[model samples]
Target: MRYHIGDLNPEELLDLYRAMLKPRMIEEKMLVLLRQGKISKWFSGIGQEAISVGVTQALREEEYILPMHRNLGVFTTRNVPLNRLFSQWQGKKSGFTQGRDRSFHFGTQEHRIVGMISHLGPQLGVADGIALADLLRRKRRVTAVFTGEGATSEGDFHEALNVASVWNLPVLFCIENNGYGLSTPTKEQYNCKDLVDRAKGYGMESRIIDGNNILEVYTKVNELCNAMRKRPRPILLEFKTFRMRGHEEASGTKYVPEKLMKKWAKKDPIANYEEFLLEKGILTEAIIDGYKNEISTEINSNLKLAFDEPAIDSNETKELNEVYQKFDYEYFEKSEDVENIRLVDAVSQGLEQSMERYNELIIMGQDIADYGGVFKITEGFTAKFGRSRVRNTPICESAIVSAAMGLSINGMKAVVEMQFADFVSSGFNPIVNYLAKVHYRWGQNADVVIRMPCGAGVGAGPFHSQTNEAWFTKTPGLKVVYPAFPDDAKGLLTTAINEPNPVLVFEHKGLYRSVYGDVPKNYYTIPFGEANLLRSGESLSIVTYGAAVHWALEILDKHPEIDADVLDLRTLQPLDVESVFRTVKKTGKLIIVQEDTLFGGIASDISAMVMENCFEFLDAPVQRVASLETPVPFAKNLEAKYLPKQRFEAALLELYAY
Candidate 1:
């Protein structure tokens, strides 16, 4: 509990010195390796070492810390092996990311570290989610997240702070004010006098500390941790510091004024701490040289081992086995206990069953609490799961998704709901770049699901009625499922919750109340990448998903003369290509339909696959019936023409006649 340098013993003071000194020594040597082309890139934390070291030392082992690229001292101080760190720098198989990414861009659960996304601001929200997990588990741990002064300008900064303050979660937001974003100064970044001053907008507690004084940082952060542990709350700490080196080794710091650099050189964190310890008789020249010699030998010997480690590459099956967490894709079972229900009720029952099964499962979205969301899918969730499990988030899509990632990092499953599928554009950065990429980058599975209410038949116009399932199907490391019937909706959504990786459940808004089917009362799952044979005929193959499936069914029942084999693709991402080809080969013709526009729809990809692989089996040319390349219109006649339903009959007849 004694945090002040004056109250510390000689050994404890030396520990602090060693923690700060090792990163400086390693990075100083990394400069030599960069010149020799041994490592491709390095982000220097030369003078800003105290922020990382002091923060790491002040927190408990279980408390997670999300770090930016420049926080190398956090890794070193935590005692992650020198060889593994160096292996990462060398793109070797033994690295933290298995050579998938370089630098401190990956996190290891072994160290309770969640590496920041390249965007630099989403980690703050992740910290909030980790803190939320601790609170739910009744643990006395506070989450720490770091960012540069430049990142405060991002909208995520506002969302993370506001959400933490609103919920009163235990989080310490450390802003390393290193004077530059890449080349831009703090003056050009924001109008605030200091970065901590921005915390007032969220009505949160804040402090300004001299980051160069390691003791001051350690002492103040330690006291704050003790306080937050007792009474959970969020605080913003602005660590006034400077980047003594360039952003990376390749970029020179010529843009920074020489006079300013000279002024900060005198305030070097390691030197400042060393001088105090020396005056107190806690350090000697021998101790300094002794640390340097010890660290140098460790770096050199480990560099050799790292050099010998094999450099991993894509498709190296033996080395890349853990890229993404494997799931039991065959979790589905048929049950005789059935009831007629709408698609929305089936979805609600599926969520309820998943919640009853897994206590760690959390559902979060705007107006999803007492209001029960706009679509009423989560009408009674808050009452059953409590506010902690069924949380109502601010209208912050990016932070909401990032917070789910944080929850996943803490070994919890999360389901984030976007009221309208069109709103996914706001959270695209984290969904595509972070959630979709983290597993492949670091092998950290994001066990999160995003419920997307999509489609265009409701006449909600372009913004609310956009079928954007195609956007996510192109992205890897994510499962995309769209169901037309209630049976498949409950089955696929339950499967999504059970999945270890991120899954997007595109629940068609039109089918929620309109479509009805016999769904099992008991819990069950439907395997992904499996197609349902809805109708069997030899005339032609009608392939579709979502609302278009119903339109195809309507056309077939009205005219029994047109015999067609209908294949309902439950999942678009894993896309049952085998079934598509089978149906194509059986009928010797095909027609792919979707609610989305025709230009760049998922139909084009399926058409290409059919032409490439199943061309010889086809008796006639393949055709695609889709909406025109335009936004959904509000007018009834225009919307009717914009959707694929009106053209389904003609396309099917043409394909059947061929």
Candidate 2:
């Protein structure tokens, strides 16, 4: 389409001008606040306000937005109350995150804007998922995600764009080419001349506009957005602009050339827009001054209110007030008829049952469709639920996680599978930063279950065989579940799906087909923060979970002389603390065993808890048996030496003697 200067009506043009002016002024005030030591940091969008305002103005009221930190103009344009914005920046209790997060790190489900984190690019896939949900619902809406030129280097950028293009999702990926990432120039950042050119590789429609010119941005974005609503497809829109300031307040522009700064100053978005409006007889100097005064008074009043608001108490900030939504699984009834089932089959059955009960549930993973998965845990799922519900995703772990988060955000219970638990390292940012904090930060439901095939007994080597439960357990706002038995596997998996929170299920790879037990045919849910007493003896307390649960049982059954109380902790995050401490009191001597490495594992946490609670009850010092600190070796004998059994038996004898 040809660029038209007069596309937007005069009233719309005036609104756009005001929109650009709002953030520019707000950022200026934020800089002053930063200097005053009120606000700690400021990511200014002084010269780049046009793009943020124009893009937001082009969108419909209901369209979803995922904005980066610099896009304060986008927030103002979205009709976000200025008081709340000030409250968030001031770190007051009235902030969107209740002062948990400062600055632009706040969003609400009501506004349909998923807030950006320090890790910016993962939100692209999340926006894609929202677009996917809109498409599924046949809703004529677009999802706009904003990021900087440097973010194109991230794996999530490529993954999100590829998935959106392949699915023909109604996603508008807006890249603000502000010439620098922190202090590094765009020339040094990437090999390409224009980042928007990469859109051709994904078969997406591309457009580049003068970001400083609000009319050009508004016209082109408005046109494309209208077209996308009719036929959903991803659009890569590049806004060529300038930051006009350092990355943040403390980050001065000493590294930025003076010449470039002076040149961008002449092209200030707000000043240029005001000049154009004045020349066109659209806005007189008096009207412009009145608008500026009105905005200034509004900002000052809101700032005073926000500044007067009390800060959250230090005691409140100690732990994230992550609200866990209680799930009632009355529909899940235990079956009297027990059938011998493999752990893997039990997981598959549990998923099928959940999907049968909740039709909105969807399963996604690599090779999970026709191929079932690398472990075949999702075998026959596609045939049962069809390819729509049981989706086969790409090898990109981050995309899978972010997209699943988006699915959950859009009211679908997403059950995603990580091909191997080790591969989760690639998608760790979204899992830890995004998915985990979604509900805690925004008060929205992040109902996604990530099934991780964990553990290292079968010698799958470093990349494939990592017991990463501790990684997720350490992260707040996530529920971690690991089950040792077939019954618990089915029950817990069901619970994870039903629960309205992000749950990471660590399914041991070695026990998938190797272990079998009587599992009920009926649906059931194993409550979190609950432990099962596998063996009732009191020589010592052997607290363990997953594959190690059976190992501890084996050791006790073999050596009846070393009789012990075995407790299986099903959930790791909301740990079964009461049961563990009770058993520790009974046994006096406690031995914590885990399949993960000796250092930085769950065993240390259990030992510390025991020391804090049952220190006086101990007959001897607490001992722990865990895998060696080294990475899992490829050789079978070396890998076997690296794990428990040998360590456990030796620890048992030493503690028995002690």
What clash pairs does model 2 have?
A: none
Q: How do the residues 1-658 of candidate 2 rate in per-residue lDDT, one tens digit apiece?
A: 1235665688988888888888888888888888889887788888888888888888887888889888888889887888888888777777898767878887777776778888888899999888888887789999999999989899999999998988899999999999999999998989987898999999999998899888889888999999999988999988989888889867878998899889888887778778777888989989888988999999999998888888775564444445554456445678798899999999988988999999878888889999989888878888788887888887788987999888887888899899998998998999999888767675777899999998887878888998988888988789999999888999999998988889999999899999999999988887888899988887888899999998888877788898788899988978989999999898888889999987878999989988998899999988888888888887899999988878898898899779
**Global lDDT scores for all candidate models:** 0.89, 0.86
Instruction: Give all candidate RMSDs, comma-separated.
Output: 1.8, 2.2
List where candidate 2 sits over 4 angstroms from the true fold. 1-3, 314-331
Model 1, runs deviating above 4 Å: 1-6, 313-323, 330-332
**Which pairs clash (backbone N, Cα, C closer than 3 Å) in model 1?**
none
Per-residue lDDT of model 1, residues 69-144, tens digit only: 8899899877889999999888888888777787888898998988887788888888988899888898999999
Best by lDDT: 1
